[model samples]
Target: MINQKSEVKVFPTNLMKQKETTTKLAIILPGAGYTSQGPLLHFSSGHYFKQEHDVLQVNYRFSEAELNPFDTDGFSANVLHTLEETLKETAYDQCFIVAKSIGTIALANLLKHPTFHNASAIWLTPLLHRDDVYQAMLQYENNSFCIIGDKDFCYREERFANLKSNPSLKTLLIPNGDHSLENKEDVLGSIDMLKNVIDGVIQFSN
Candidate 1:
């Protein structure tokens, strides 16, 4: 079943049988300007849906003034509020998060929530520049996967190395890939990069 609304879209695998078996929910959080329909998130959510997981894609919109400091606590708060309210009544045995860019800030906040403490995450091009995002990644105790491009402005070698120290965390660095994990000089290479990231997601699912 599918439901499309202003703030979010829901794709349910088995609404009637959700309570009979363990329920798996996948939440896709997009970047500031990137919508859930973007390549990475669109495909990721489709994959989760194919696997019989209920998928929720958040379509958050913010004004220019509100986004001036996209990584601020206020911005994170608004995202968190929307998420918590939208999901307050949903029932699931497991939760999975796929977050990119500013969504990573939301992921940081979600990690602290009691309901999602054990949730696994796929962080794509996270804003490691933000102290909160970095600290959350540093202290996360559950299974999580992260992918970032070496060329992205948010990418920090020292910080990436530190995150790798966490045995439970899996990190993938795309050479010459930008914030979108695309190679500006080679479209074919960018496609390959996407394939590699999807492969990581598949492995993480297992």
Candidate 2:
């Protein structure tokens, strides 16, 4: 199912095998404000569903109250608490993640849990400067892929080349896309980039 709302959408999958069923969950952590309703996150969910994996798009809220630096801890704590609750009841065959921006920060914490070990990920528009974000990706380099636009504010000139050293990771750089991997002046170009993002996701995930 396509994720069209700012609510946790779970596309449940069931496969009967001698009266037993199994589920593979792909948790999506979208960027703050952008949400999973956006085209990139939405189409990515479709790809997982097509592969018979249950997609869990975790929708979170961010308010002006969380704007300050101190509140960053509070916000991350909230997101972490939600993740704990989300996983308390289910046991999945293969647990995967698709996180963007702030979601990647939360995911950095999530990766520490033993439950998420060996899990693969697709990190979009990450805050590469952050120690935690890049560290987590590096720790799980073999099981993860990252995509960022060259035009994004976080795109560091000095570190980008070094980041490419990890051949296990598949990193994509959209030419003129900003944080959203979009081209505002050229609508057609933006559309093509979106398609390219989807293709990259499919290739990495599959």
Best by TM-score: 1
lDDT of 2 by residue, 1-206 (tens): 11222233332222212223456777888886778878998898887877777767777655555433324445455666666665667678787788988888877877776777667878899888888787777666557788888988877655666667776667788899889989889999999999999999988887
Model 2: residues >4 Å from true position, as ranges?
A: 1-20, 70-73
> Candidate 2, which ten residues in sequence have the lowest lDDT sum?
10-19
Deviation in Å, model 2, residue 183 alpha carbon: 0.6
Candidates' lDDT values, in order?
Answer: 0.81, 0.73
Query: What stretches of model 1 exceed 4 Å from their correct place?
Result: 1-22, 69-71
Candidate 2 TM-score over all chains jointly: 0.84
Please give the range of 10 consecutive residues that has the lowest summed lDDT in model 1. 1-10
* TM-score, one value per model: 0.86, 0.84
Model 1 / residue 20 / CA error / Å: 9.1
Q: Which whole-number lDDT from 0 to 100 does residue 145 have in model 2?
A: 80
Can you write out model 1's per-residue Cα lDDT over 1-206, one digit (the tens) per residue?
A: 11121233232211222333447888888887787878888888878877878787777766676566444555556556666676677778988899999889889988888888899988899999889899889889999998999999999999999998888899999999899999989999999999988888988987
